[model samples]
Target: MINETELIEQLKRGDDTAFRTIVEQWQDMVYNTILGIVQNETEAEDLAQDVFIKVFEKIGTFKGDSKFSTWLYRIATTTALDHLRSRKRKKRSGFLQSLSGSGGEEKEQIPDFHHPGVSLDNKERAAVLFKAIDELPDNQKAAYTLHKLEGLSYRDVSEVLNTSVSAVESLMSRANQNLRKQLEEYYNKHYR
Candidate 1:
């Protein structure tokens, strides 16, 4: 296996094999990052492909300031957020069209996203936690997803978010509170 430095050097030289190797090595990481944010399997898959395309196209701009995985993860997170924003814009447009009596595209259903890395016995519990995560504000959700779901360190998440670690900590604290509230409400509503 080629070392990452050598592989990146080959990629910068436009070597197809090196590009393929990078894709194969990093695809799951990219996919899971997008999946954690977007919470839709099909959209995550599509956006993951888009992330790699951007990585390939921008390979020459890599400065080696951070690890390749860090750079790649930043791209994946940004791509996923972009996808979510575009979908929201479309949904608003579709709603406006319907208000004007013009039939619009049907709303897409978001499934209960199951992380492939989650243990089989924990799937249902993880699903509930993810549903609460989906309710978090964008910043809090991104922080939590990167730190808790993706297992990135707080410093790494701060770097990806372009924020201080303290800010990441605050976001995580709020996220934890919100998640607890949501879970409590859910349990009270269903289990009462």
Candidate 2:
């Protein structure tokens, strides 16, 4: 139950108990942030573990200019984005190999994602929304996830994203437009 400053100080001194406390406190937030981006439970779990490891190793680098949670959010988003990029690269290579007739693996597809935070009655709609989210560019996706999903304020999201508040606002506006277009398309295709 120590204050965050004390906990951070203990962590910097390599106190195992403090590390455990920090993980216990922030694990859910970290996991949920990653899950919003990656949209796969298994990958989100693995990336959450990786986020904690990064926190443990990089605790000294935390400057305390922003809230600890904001720093952690930055790490989680960066890790998830990196994993997504790596996955895309692998898929591209696999596609090239298939084109060359040296590999026969089928193209990978993004599965429908159900965010745990969604209510049971909304799971179907949430899955459709998440699929559209997955199509957004990375910055827009991160801004939308942090602001809309994680309930961060525009300024806090700007801090996590290392950008200006206006930039976050711009990202959000574009995200909303894109999501509306995508959802409208889905509606037309499925219900028309």
Local distance difference test values of all predictions, in order: 0.88, 0.93
True-vs-predicted CA distance for residue 76, candidate 2, Å: 0.6
Question: Which regions of candidate 1 are displaced past 4 Å?
Answer: 104-109
Clash pairs of candidate 2? none
RMSD of model 2, in Å?
A: 1.1
lDDT of 1 by residue, 111-174 (tens): 7878888999999989999989988887888888888877999999988888899999999999
Error of 2 at 152 (Å): 0.3
RMSD of every candidate to native, in Å, equals: 2.0, 1.1
Q: Please name the candidate that would achieve the greatest lDDT relative to the true structure.
A: 2
Q: Which stretches of candidate 2 lie over 4 Å from their true place?
A: none
Over the stretch 1-192, how does candidate 2's per-residue lDDT look in tens digits? 599999999999999999999999999999999999989999999999999999999999998999999999999999999998998898888899999999756777767998888999999999999999999999999999998878999999999999999999999999999999999999999984
Q: State how far residue 40 of model 2 sits from its true place (Å).
A: 0.6
Collision pairs in model 1: none
